[model samples]
Target: MFRATTATIHTLCMLALAGCQPSSDGRDHGQMQLDACVAEACTTLNLDGYGMRDYNAVAGLAHVTSLMVSYTDFADLSELAAMSQLRELHMGMTEVTDLDGLAAFPNLEVLHAQYLEPQSFAPVAGLARLRELAVGSAGLDDLSFVAQMPALHRLLVVNSVQGLDLSPLAGHPGLRALDLRASDGMDLRPLLTLPNLQEVALSRIGEDIDPTQAQVVAQLRARGVSVDLDAIVVPVC
Candidate 1:
């Protein structure tokens, strides 16, 4: 009978373990693609359809300008802190819950935050350079953040925010277009205070508009603003 030495057994065990482990090169296909994108300095990166949750590789992409991460499983925006050059970010249909990392991008211009219900929109309050914001179906109720954004001209809030409050939008300096489907009983007096308001498309979610709201709409139209109030149906005589 041949006696196996301890060294021989240890060597055999090591080889077996090495064989069991997956090769690092083939382990992560997404990481490899991301690495290639970073190497090429690709400005636009679309991470949709990857079903990826880990964003560690995204930190290396410093030159990415337009990033579309819809359909991803990422819950936070921390990994994108290094991407300060990002201008347009489309984050629709994602699981992202927090936007604290958005503070890093000071030059962000366009933001499409549709279909995501963030805990708070406070992080966006500091984005002074953000111009276009589309928040359709985001279930946002608070418009206080918009008051701080002086450059915001276009705001789209369709199919969200029941019993909406327009007090926050009062006295907006550059607000030109407003499109929203708000529930009935919303205060429409705030629309009169916007200095540059040029267009409005309001659709009520409930029955006939109140007399006060109708009067407000009439006043807005009287001011040369193109107002479309199809939902404001007065009771038939």
Candidate 2:
């Protein structure tokens, strides 16, 4: 749990320094509302834009388990290094360029990141406890990292870089559900090798697609895995 005393002190100091005053405009704007974040025992932090960049503000919340950050300019997650108990993270439409800070949370289970700049997900592959992963990026091309996540069960990938290869997902021991979208053709044969697959949804973002993709879908259906080609599956946290 968070040290209430520490958070109180920090909050008061921040408030005093900023000289926070009620705006005559009566509109909710500016940086993240710091006082509201600590009201819930500081266990869950939701930062929704407004130029919130000071990650150190929540570093004292040692027990925080779920965090959501969006529409910010911070490129890396280095400031969140102290949140070791974090389990779920929803970071979308942010300036985050790399996932190096993920190493701090060995217990993380669910991760959702989208609309990011080009970057390698090399660090995410090391999360041994991760079960569900949702990522959308035009810059993410190499997916070999998925092979290392033996515990992964559900995966959602959207807007992949053109010509993305999904060979890394073959023969996954525990994967049960998968949702993917691509603007270009990608080999879909890997889905056939997933022994535990139960459901799959594929969305074509462009007209270009492999001719054999229909056959692959049929094969998965024959094997009792539900496949939906026309449906668009969006992952959320």
State which candidate has the highest lDDT.
2
**Per-residue alpha-carbon lDDT of candidate 2 for residues 15-116, written as tens digits (9 for 90 to 100):** 542332234322234233555766657677765454354767666777679877655554567777788889987776667877887888899998877667
Query: Per-residue CA lDDT of candidate 1, range 1-237, in tens?
Result: 001123354565455434323344432644665767877888877664353436766766777888866545666787778878889887765677788888988889988675678887778878888877766454677888899999998876644566778899999997888766554567889999999998887664335778998899899999998876543311100
TM-score of 1: 0.71
lDDT of 1: 0.70
Best by TM-score: 2
Error of 2 at 191 (Å): 0.5
Worst 10 residues of 1 by lDDT: 1-10
Give me the runs in candidate 2 sitting further than 4 Å from their true place. Answer: 1-33, 50-53, 205-210, 233-237
